[model samples]
Target: MEVVSSVRTPLITGGKTVGDVTQDICVRVEAKPPKSWFLAMAISLTFLFVGLYAVFTTAWEGIGVWGLNKTVGWAWDITNFVWWVGIGHAGTLISAILLLFRQKWRMSINRAAEAMTIFAVICALFFPFIHMGRLWLGFYWVMPLPNTFGSLWVNFNSPLLWDVFAISTYFTVSLVFWYIGLIPDFATIRDRAKNKVSAVIYGALSFGWVGSAKDWSRYESVSLILAGLATPLVLSVHTIVSFDFATSIIPGWHTTIFPPYFVSGAVFSGFAMVLTLLLITRKVYKLEDYISVQHIEFMNIIIIVTGSIVGIAYLTELFIAWYSGVPAEQYAFLNRATGPYWWAYATMMTCNVVTPQLFWFKKIRTSLWATFFLSIIVNIGMWFERFVIIVTSLHRDFLPSSWAMFYPTFYDVGDYLFTFGIFFTFFFLFAKFFPVINMAEVKSIIKSTSTSDKALK
Candidate 1:
């Protein structure tokens, strides 16, 4: 038995061979889902139908059905948009950023993460479209198309328009990158397909992948190129989203730190989401050996660092508000921490900042149960972080006379649930119908796991 050395520790465990990797991942797609999967699907579909009903009612009755008023026009719609967009970032980072850094740990997690990224962006896109009262016209109107009305075009200066381009580009790139990575795995599934339907679908998706040395050579080259393209692209997506607020003259929204702060928060929430989804996924699918404790520990470390950065950003906002001596900014910060919605502020502080700090302990970071709960807490804190930024800023501006409180209606809650439905529906389908793990990439690392085991011996 020849021993192979690796740069870092092994990613796979259980002494899996290449054949074992293919059989393990492919059988997941070929078999019927467990009873738990159906229960989850039923729950997801209930939310989905509820969301659809809300969307239909909103369309029939108009945007007035929800909680939008003159002062707090954005409310939950934009907050959910930013939150979903932030959640999408971790997927791209897991796939592209880690790939660029040549981190083998990413190989175990990136496929599912990339799928999560695509689904999350899909959820984020719903708000802007649904926010338009006349969604029919608003859809094409937002695009920079040559129209019969001469020289009429979208505002190039608007960050909202920039978001349109940024998100669309990010989605396109992520989709292509994810699909490209899936080709080899898809081919693996195609080869092992027992039925004609599975064979044809997987064959078409694989694009005639033959597993030649030349084919693999090109595959690696393409993956590397795409990773380079996606690295800055993911960062830019969230940064542009932050610009939607930072470019505003609103007292709390106008901050120079918005870009990096938003990016860190996005990555932080994204990792929390990945942890939440993957923890359940690995256990449900019996993939603990592939996704292992070491991988969880490393992701926990990222959450700790990014969570700390977010906490610092919170304090920095307070310091800058007071240091500037701008009365409106000062009052905005004060209102956030002590206003009618102070509970939201407190929740954000506790969840986003304080909770993730537990990862600093080895015991907490490595514990699957602990990581699962903290991941959910981090997302909740992140949601509040967005809510605090959007609603708190808009509800009270420079004018004392224009001040008002924001509240979400049943429809608002429904649309938020809709995103969850969209996310989980797509995720469960992907898990069952496709290779959740990247078989080819994991195969390359099988020997690395063996080498590490030998070293321990």
Candidate 2:
């Protein structure tokens, strides 16, 4: 009699064994950080310092340092916060929601996406905190503790408070999800440890796991439970972020359609971001076999579908504004199309509405360079989408006397640069230190699909 283990075989192509898969991931994960890592770190650190300097200068001088005026109160800081938060959504959606849906393809890229989510949320946090000139008292906005200065309670009805709750919850949950998934891989690294320092560090992180059957069982169960917890959380985070605008009395922000609209846009941009990162990681790490053309094509389809939903939302907003017959609403819609910020509006339409249509072709979707370019376009469009929504609509309120144009000051621009630095800086570090691909998930996928490999081949 012979004993067979499913874990030993290749699940997809049958061209490689499970050992091959593990070896491939180990090689990449254990490799020394490249020269590019140092270069990127130096540049990002420089920019981060510049960003901090600008923030402190603004804080010391007052909010007057920013281009934001009484008429246009929320400027680049708030816009960047919303944009980065939306970008962070794609990570949890891919890891949690798609995992629950049993999408095997997500296994190849979920690790990097989850890392991106955590980092993007970190970047998002800077805006709300620093945007308040008196950063020391920033906690007053959310703290339920009694304040003697004014004896005023924090506004429970305010969407800003909701943002504080929603973003904090989203960030904490994402961090836990990411760290949990890394435990097994960290143990794998621990066992393969070649030095005392590496052994102790990895051992401590792995939590004394010996990968027993019982441990694997509990691990799998915990992952599923966490995924279940994260699914609604991913949706709720963006929906609440939308309420920050939708609950407002401003014309464009007052629409009932904002929650779904923002969620779809968040997913669309999030997928775009995931695509951008995975494309590079697969190439850099030589995991083309794990992150295959098929995976890229599947995600492209998602990008197209969600992109179309966002495109429809754009048109529908216009239709509803007209049909509502509210003068303020109609004017806001008209302003988006033909107002002072029409250039920004046109840029959004081009990037969000038109550029993504190229993915309808399989050639474009699978072409790494093409997808990369489109991803940047999608990001640019998404940023402009927020800009157009926040700035253009507020530039001219209900009254002509209140109308004003908004432009970003140097501090405003520095804040945006800082956000980019934060996102890329964390990503660069992630690529260096961790297995950007989730080895455990990929191994499981390989194990489960081994039988299908024979038939396909």
TM-score leader: 1
Q: Candidate 1 at residue 336, lDDT?
A: 94
Worst 10 residues of 2 by lDDT: 1-10
| C-alpha root-mean-square deviation, each candidate | 2.0, 3.3
Q: Write model 2 residue lDDT over 1-457, tens digit each, in one string.
A: 2333556433244354567766777766577866666887899888887887777787788878889876788878888898899889989988999889988778878899999999989988888888777878887756766777545777789888888888999999999989989998888888888889888988999888888999999988999999999999989988998998898899998978888889989988888898888887777676777777777888888889989999999999999999999988998989888988889999999999999999999999988889889998999999999999899878887668988888788888877787777788889888877767787777766645544434433
The digit string of per-residue lDDT tens for model 1 on 353-422 reads 8889999999999999999999999999999999999999888866779889987899999988988998
Highest-lDDT candidate: 1
What's the lDDT for all of these models?
Answer: 0.91, 0.84
lDDT of 2 at 92: 94
lDDT, residue 383, model 1: 96
